[model samples]
Target: MSHANAALTPRHRLRIARLIVDEGWTVVAAAHMFNVSWPTANRWAQRYAAMGVAGMDDRSSRPHRSPNKTDQQLVRKIVHLRWKKRLGPVAIGGKLGLSASTVHAVLVRCRLNKLHHVDVRTGEVIRRYEHATPGAMIHVDVKKLGKIPDGGGSRYVGRQQGNLNIRATAGRPKNNKRGRVAGITFVHTVIDDHSRIAYAEVHANETADTAVGVLRRAVSWFAARGVTVERVLSDNGPAYVSHLWRDACNELGIKPKRTRPYRPQTNGKIERFHRTLADGWAFGKFYNTDSARNNALPGWLHEYNHHRPHTAIGNRPPMSRLTNVPGQYN
Candidate 1:
C-alpha cells in the first residue's frame, strides 16, 4: 500500500509513467502535471521502461539485506526456545546471553511475540473455532476460590487479621492437632460456545453430585433464555467423569463430551470464562463477608448476561444472541 504522503496511487503512477514513456512527455512536465517531484516522476518512468506495469506498484520498504541481523543458527535457536521452552523474550535473552530487546525484535519478526499465538498441543499457530449456535455445545468447568472468612479476607481487612479469622473459623476446630484447612468455594460454570452466555453456581465441594446438580440448573436456565443445550463439553476431572454425571446427562437428553487428557485447550471456552469470572466478579470487589459476596454473584451474572459488553460477541451483551426471547432488551 502507498503511504499517506505519497504523491500518486498506482493508477495515477501508471498514467504518469505512460505519459512520460509512451506519450514522450518530458519528466518535468509530467511531474508538474501530477503535482509530484521531478525525480519521483522520472523514477516511475525508468521503472516502467525496465519492469513494465508491475513497477508502478508499491514496493516493500524493508532493506534487501542486513549484515548485522542475527545469524540463521541463532535465529533457529531463538525460535526453538519460543516453541519448545515457551520462554519470553527476557528469559530467552538471559539464557542465550543476548539483550532482551534483541530477542524481542527477533520474536516479532518470527510472529511469535505473544505466547498465545502458538498452540501448545501442536506447536503451530493457534486456530480458534466456535460451534454454530447457542447451546449447540456448551463448555463446563469449575473454578476454586478461597472463601473469605465471615468478617473479611486480607483484600479488605489487614493481612494479620485475615490470618486470625482463618485460624478462628477453620473447617477444623482450632483445638485439633491436624493442620487446619480454610474454606474453598467451587464455582461451577457452563458457557455456550457460540454466544458466550454463561451460568454458574458457587458450591462447597466439586463432588460429582454437586456438578450434576449444577448442570441440571444450567440447562434449565439456558432453556428459559430460549436456548436448548444439545451437548456438554468438560475436562476429564473426577467429578465430570463420574457415573452420576453420566446419568445426569442421559436424563437431560444431552450428549456429553470430554477434552483429551491433560489438554484443557480442547475445552477452551469455559476455561476462558473462569478467568473472566474471577476478574469481573469473584475478586472485582472487596466483600466484608463471604455470604455477601455469594449473594452478589447473581446480580453480577445478570449484568453480564443482559448489560455488560462482551468483546468476543461484537461487544454486545450475551443476551443479544437470544433475540427471539420475549424479554431480551433493556
Candidate 2:
C-alpha cells in the first residue's frame, strides 16, 4: 500500500503500467514520465501482464505467508487453555513452557487479550454499552489523592527534604511517635455520559455535603452550557446514598443512581476520567506546593472541556459535542 504521503496513487500506477504495456513505451520512458525508478515501472508492467488493470492497484506490502509465525496448532492450544482454565498470560506461559510475552501475543492474535472480551463459561463476545445523549446521564465519583507536603512533595524535593517538610507541617508529637498524618484530598468528578465533558474539584473530604455541593456546582456549570443533569450515576458510597445527597438531587430535579455493588465499571466514565486526571494533571507536573497543584486544576479543566481532544469523540474536544449553550467554558 502507498504511504500516507506517497507521490503516486493506484490510479497513477495504473496509468504508468498502461503506458509501458499497452502504449509499447519502454520501462525507462514510463519511469521518467512518472518520476519513479525503472524497476517500479517494470513491476507495474509485470502486474498488468499477469492480471490486467486490477493488478496495477496498490497491494499490501506484507508477505503473503510468514514461515517463522507460530503454528496454528500451538495457537489453538493456547486459546483452549485460556478458555478452559481462565489462566493469565504468565501462568499459561509457565504451563506451556513459552515466554509470557509469546503467550500474550498469541492470545492477542486470537482476540483473547482481555477476559472481559470472552465469556468465562461459554467464551462468547460480551456486548459493550454506550449512552446516546449528552447529559442524559452523568457519572459522579471521587478519587482520593495524597496531599503534597506543606512546602512541596517528594516529586519536587528529595525524599529527605519531603520528610523535613512533613515534619515541619505536622510537628513532632508529644509522645514522639511520628508526625501527623498527611491529609488526603478527595477530587469530586462529574462527566457527561455521551460527550465525556468532565468537571472536577479538589476538596478536603468526600462527605455527603461535599458531594452534594460539588454536584450542585457541576449541574450549574453544565446548565449554563445547555446540558441539564437528568440523572446522576455513582457508586454505592455512603456519601452517594446519604439523605443529604438525595435531597440535593431532588432539589435540582435530577435523579440519583448508583452502580451495582462492587461493580465500579457501571460508573466507568468517571473512573476513566480519574486515570486521565492523574496522568494529565495531578501527577503530570512537579509543584512546589499543594496550592500550586490546586490552582492548576481550573486550567486543566478548561483544556479538558474546551481544548484537549478526546479519542471517543472523534478527536474533538468534548465541548464540540455540547449543544444549546456556548461552545466553551467562557
Candidate 3:
C-alpha cells in the first residue's frame, strides 16, 4: 500500500484491524484496504489493543524546560507597582533602582503593559513643552462652563422614572441658559513652563477682579512651592485686556504678556492645561451639582501634581521634578 493513497481516519483503520481479527483477513489484505504499509497497520492494531482510541492522539512537541525565564520576584514587584501603586515602568524602575530595560522586561513577563486600557472618547494627545528653568514663563487661562447637576443621572431614568426632562435634569436650568453662566464659573489655571507645576482656582466670574484674585492665588501657590512667576501669558480676552489686570501684574512685580487676538498658541501652555482638565478630569464624570465638580477639583489637582507621570518630565510627577529652593520665588 502506498503512503499517497493512505486513509488517515481512525475509524477506517479500526475497521480494517477488526476485519483481520473477526474475518481472518490477511495482514497484506488489510493493509491494501487501508492503503497503508504492513508496519503501519500492525502499529495501529497494537495501539488499539493497548489503549483503545486514546493512543492515536499526537504527543506534545513543546520542550520540558525554559532556560531564560524571568525572575519571579522581579516580575511580582513590577506588576505590584503597575497595578497596586499605579506607577509606570520608568518610575517603578526609579523606585526599585533598576534600569528601564530591566523594568520593562519584568513588566513584559508579568503582562503589565498588556492590561492598560484607554477610553475611546479621549481626545488626541498634544505634544508637551518643557521649560529648562522655573519661572521662564507661566501660562494662565479661564474656562467657563455650565453648572452640573447633583446626584448624577441613573441609566434607567427614562424607562423606570419616565423622566423625559433630559435638558432640565442633565444640564443647567432654562432661565440660566444665557451667557451669564458661560461668562461665570471660570476655571483659572496657571502652569509653570519648566516644571509643568499647575495651580488652578474655580471662580464665579471671569471679570478682571476675579482674574486678579486667580493670579494672586496662583502666585502664592507657586511661591509656597518655591517657583517664582517671572512672566505670565494669557489670551486677549476682555478681562485680560483691562487695565486692572495689568495693574495687578505691576503690583506683583511680574511681567504680564498677552497673546495676539485670536492666536491662542502664544499661550499654548494654558490651552493645553484646559484640555488636560477637560479630558483627564471632567470628560467621563457626571457631577449633579457645581459644588460636586468643585469638590473633586482638589483631589484631581493632587493627583496631577503628585501621582500622574508626565512623559515630558522624563516620566516623573511635576511635584517630584520640582526643586524646593526658597529663594527661587523670592
Candidate lDDT (C-alpha), each: 0.86, 0.84, 0.71
Q: Per-residue lDDT for 1-330 in model 3, tens only?
A: 315555656566677666666567877888898788998777767776677667654447767986766567867777767766667778988998888888887766655565434211222123345667887788888877555433333332322222233244544445544312212367878888887878888877788988898899888878777777888888888888899999999999899888887766567767777888987766547665567778888889888888889877799887775646654322
Ranking by lDDT: 1, 2, 3
lDDT for 27 in candidate 3 is: 77
Model 2 — TM-score against the truth?
0.67
- The alpha-carbon lDDT assigned to residue 61 of candidate 2 equals 85
Alpha-carbon shift of residue 256 in model 1 (angstroms): 1.0
- lDDT, candidate 1, 1-330, per-residue tens: 787777798888999999999999999999999999999999999999999999988889899999899988888999999998888899999998999999999999998888777887566677789888888999999999877876777776777777766676646335433322346788899889998888899998999999999999999888877788999999999998999999999999999999999888788878888888888898898887777889999999888888999998899998888887765443
Model 3: lDDT to the true structure: 0.71
Each prediction's RMSD over C-alphas, in Å, is: 4.7, 7.3, 18.9
- Using all chains and alpha carbons, the TM-scores for the candidates as numbered come to 0.76, 0.67, 0.53
lDDT of 1 at 88: 88
> Could you tell me how far off, in angstroms, the CA of residue 98 lies in candidate 3 after the best superposition?
54
Model 2 ranges with Cα > 4 A deviation: 1-110, 113-126, 170-181
Model 1: lDDT equals 0.86
Best by lDDT: 1
